[model samples]
Target: MKTATGCTVISNGTAVIGTGAAPIKDATIVIRDGKIAYAGPVAQAPEVEPDATVIDARGGTILPGLIEAHFHPTYFNVEALEDLDIKYPVEYVTLLAASNAKLALECGYTSARSGGSLFNIDVWLKKALECDLVPGPRLAASGREICGVGGLMDWNPDYRKIGMDGLVLLVNGPDEARAAVRKLVKDGVEWVKTYPTGDAASPDVNDHHTLCMTFEEMHAVVATAHNHGLKVTGHCRATEGIKNALRAGYDTLEHGTFVDDEALEMILERNTPVVPALYFELASIERGPEFGLSQRVIDGHQETLEGGAESARRILRAGGRLGMGGDYGFGWNPHGQYARELSFFVNYVGLTPLEVLTCATKTGAEILGREHELGTLEAGKLADVLIVDGDVIGNISLLEDRKRFIAVMQGGIIKAGELFRSQA
Candidate 1:
């Protein structure tokens, strides 16, 4: 794949299926012009480009590159949200975001959807990755999240003259919400992320259960973004927030920890995808001390964790799509450990290993609206592939190591690992 030519082929592997009907044994995948030409048994392999580069998986598992449905590339390696909002300079955060992107790619994630970012960093980074100016995943960029004043993202001290300007778009009403979303579209965002509720980490009246936006403001955001050809997702953990987002035509939900019967019904009826982001809550409880969180805050996180798990199960049982990813760049959950979400699904959410893989790949792509080109290994799909050296089905934890990958290829280009020889 380093030969400058985009033609490549990968052979001699067992393909783990992702929305491709079923798995294949002794498979051969061919990539021509950065797109899949064949993906099936080696016996029926087709001819490839005369000088095409070929990679031997050595009887490994060939799977679709994992997708991160909610990623914060601009947060960097911050110890807390305050670091991201106050201490870290915009220039440093932007540079650190580039490193995180490369790290995520090295971890075998070929695609990422930006949940939100500081200013328009995600916008510029997405363009850079697309144009080959940087090495990263195919990013669906969402710029600074729109939040109501004093909401979850409005973390600045009101009495202080200085404010956290780079982190959020502080909108006060319906008109401001509409303008915020329109400005995001104009700034080159593909998705609009909003704060429809507060955080459980907060202790005041603005707790996780507090509604951040009125119905009118939420409705205006959805309408404006949809009109400008963008999908709207929200940070909605409150039950009322979920209901409000649903009624306002929000396309997706993030961290739906407090969803109830009605919200579950609404989600299924609309077929809205949700990335439960279960790990962050657990991380807070387990590693909260290291981050200076109080005992009360840690206790609150335990409740949030239980509620998120139950909500996730209910959504899955109802046959609603559930994608993986959440707050991975924070101090507790660093980058390159994205595969942990898969384990959380199996051990906590009660999903099987196969089910977790399918959700992370196929359903994640569906959430990002790239179901055709990504999420599966088949003819005509982009060559976004991960060659794993171990039996992924038996021990999903092996994915936590970047070295476990024999090669990570996206669009016929090798991003990590090495594939030296081929027989085509």
Candidate 2:
């Protein structure tokens, strides 16, 4: 339930302050009317009214609620795109999408940005969550992916040419590209997704070398999106595709698994955000056989898994903007395991535990363009807090356990981790 006005004093916790990567011992955070009123050392804490609700974190780490910078709420958790379309009706898929939204919040994610969605369901889902018809993270929706005809999402038999409606918007030229972006804007999306390159799962094109849409077409889409006050991102895996997308001014690159030195230089120069969702690729490798995927498809994933890690390492080492978000909601990866991406970043991508947490917290907010209000725990910011019952700084994997998340407060509302339900 949303509190109209409530004060919460969280004492006896180690507060992980925002952006600076420091912790306050014996911190006391006072939340008044759903905003962080005070967050500092216990000695400097402001005196609170006796009636205010108090939550003791038991000396656990209190960090900002994680933001899933790349999300697809309508996807079938663990199912491939083709299987999602073939195995389930749209009605079932819609219900599952709503379920995924809630799971995201339960996992301590307070916000999510839609990477893409089935139909315009993400736009409606965002609204539903806003109206409290459903429980979910704050979403920035991208209605449907804009793709060239015969692009990555052109998943259909050649002879039948079955309409893949509600998933991909097929465009051919610059005119069609511009039209598609305008239509997505009209459909109430904050971002427009495009398939700049074919993915590893595609049956029609090479995963690493093939370009899906022309440079001119992407330029048109980016221009239209920017003009309409929408961010534009692309599913780019090919080195050439990355170059084209950056040149055309796409704001973010999803699955930038094949970034060459030249592409990396351009991304650094433009300060573009890259979300290399490597967990999904790893999941594909582990569960492809169970999903009835061809060995060829399973074999192809290894390259992406290895290449994506190296690409991320390079980007991180070069001090480029890299964020965390699993391409969850597929059959194997699932929705609530977005934290696995953080572990992948630490172990495989060669980042420290603290670095991974920073990416998940601060860099994720930067990716969503909500760094001002979200991300770090600080005074005057929205109280999106995740209190984990462990030395989370020593082992980031503890965050993967929802039970360890003793309290999750989004705008001072306890959506999950009801640590003080009896007391309240």
Candidate 3:
């Protein structure tokens, strides 16, 4: 055998049917220098080098590592709102992010895109992982969300006194929006998030189609971000807001609840992917009362739950690109339960098991503009993979438990492992 350093092989596994259209049974995945070198049936796999290490998969099912396209690390504590005051504290928030990161990794999410966060903590967490100071998924973060004055959440005036300027940008007009985008880029933001439409609790004072930002203002944010080599994502729930965001060149639309037929057509025409964070709606309905939410909030959530599913169905029927993302950190939604999003996608959004898996893996990497580096199990791609104890395709819900995973590896390093049995 040829000699090589830094090599490992996962043998005798059932490779989960991938985007390539077929499953490779009795498979072996060879890794070299943190990249996949070969992935196929063991009988077809080329001979490995003499010094390579081998991991026996014990007939487990292997698949490309999962990716969560929209998550919030800092606000993860919203899962248990009885502890609200303490959950938002900076120290507590940091610990919560750390805990969520570890949970996500262990749960087979090798990479994630943090949609929005407070205090720009996602940036710090990303840096920490890169430096090996912490263990977590590979992260792409929007430092903080930029919203219109009194847009989504009210900003506290005390933020100025505490020097927490990087938390959120509350801009009022076109000029302010441009400046805010510039400031976020200067602060090392990977992407810029904007709240284009108001929520149920805070509807836009203008027409539903007319959002907080004028067309010019929205254009400025998108232009500034694109000029700086960054992408822009918008929170849009209304049909009017969805069209405006598409016209403004936003990369992705989040939580599109009231999307009409025409807007769904536009999304298909434009080829912009929509992240239907249905888990947020489901969790809100099931867990809102525990958090002391008023009846009105609970009722409003029910309406959204019903409406969002219909919109998702329409989007899928129209052949629009759809991705899976759990809006974790609100109501009972928590990090590391990403697979549940797939179940909702399959049952509620009408996606097949293969399609849902692609949304979480291949489509997710494409949304982040990292398809070549992540997404599929291919030669030269990062070695992010998961091996489950049973055939996950038949029952996707089995993925909800980390214990079902026989091995979790990221960058060719095994993060978790099951104890070995003697070869008697």
Candidate 4:
């Protein structure tokens, strides 16, 4: 593609660790029309046109924009509330979602996937970001979670009613499950989310057992979603529910808290990616009381934290694909702390600094099926890049410091940085 007007060039920076091992120093990246035209050693760069913008890197490290494969945008502003009993209006929730989107971008995430949320708010947010009506990352969203009748949320008085904010769609049998998948598709959802298990934290519910849909029901959901070109993500922490979701062919498992040896092996065999929302668990424990969450939920959260590290270690040892995502919005976990999850993955799961970064960037893109479009810093890719002040390869903690981000560019636009002010 021809270089568009107001093209930008980032030069004299150390291209940080990409998906592959090793870093390229003294690299030059050419951004033409909001896409990377070239990325390599400075010596090999093409001659820059007089009108194109050139930015000095000051020896900083440049890397591809980070990707968070799982999160909840609706819960971004939970801190504003004082009590758990305060039921937020749907409009307020949508605004919170928009704020989270912007916060994610500010935190250096160029793209993210909302695991589940209400009213398809992410869909609208994605559009807003594309149109530049709002500042945010590109979002792939699951409209609403499909659950069994009287599933995680109790609605015994009227079983037909789904959860508030149009967030949950209740389906009873195989046929209903299939229809639910189609309904989300028609609603323009890019991914489908379902609960194969109930919420363990609720005091009223049984935490150990599986809250299952029939085998046929799960099968129909998977098949229907696949046929419609959407990936199915299942919420199942209990062993039985996790196994059932796997057998049903879910593309990814969210919050796999109780996966056993057999289930882990099967996950490895199937090459299914697991997103352990460890940060969310920790945050929940910290903020549960404020949410009026029963002691059972709080206790269950503590148990998840205690065991989550071991589970992550086992999954890594088994060679299963892993991605980083803080299920934002459940409680205290907010939108901007995407890097916090990496600390848990590194300290608890024993991932090296580079490995953890790779999981968050390259591996995360693969899970979202946007490897070609989003991950890595290479020729012919979107110019989603971040420049940090310190050497990220030597110390991963540098990534957590917001001040370290000297420049944030997404699609060649200088979203942050004084260097591009003259160009603008």
RMSD of candidates 1 onward, in order: 2.7, 2.0, 3.9, 3.3
What lDDT tens digits, residue by residue, belong to model 4 across residues 1-424? 1114457888878886466667888988888888888888889999878988887777888888888888777764454322111356668877877888877877788888888777778777777877888887778888887877756633334543434336677788999999989888988888898888765465366453557466678889999999999999887777788899999999998877777889998899999888887877777777768867678877887777766667776787778777888776544665677888887677666788777777788878888898887778877777888887777777777777777787778887767544433456
Q: Estimate candidate 3's alpha-carbon lDDT, on a 0 to 1 scale.
A: 0.76
> TM-score ranking from best to worst?
2, 1, 3, 4
In every candidate, how many clashes are there? 0, 9, 0, 0
Q: CA lDDT of 161 in candidate 2?
A: 47
TM-score of each: 0.94, 0.95, 0.89, 0.88
- Stretches of model 3 off by over 4 angstroms after superposition: 1-5, 79-89, 155-166, 200-210, 417-424
Better of 3 and 4 by TM-score: 3
lDDT of each: 0.85, 0.84, 0.76, 0.76
- The residue-by-residue lDDT of candidate 1 on 54-91, one tens digit each, is 77888778999999999999987577676777776788
**How accurate locally is residue 260 in candidate 1, as Cα lDDT from 0 to 100?**
91
RMSD in angstroms, candidate 3?
3.9
Query: Per-residue lDDT of 203-268 in model 2, one digit per residue for the tens?
Result: 447465678999999999999999989999998888999999999999999988899999999989
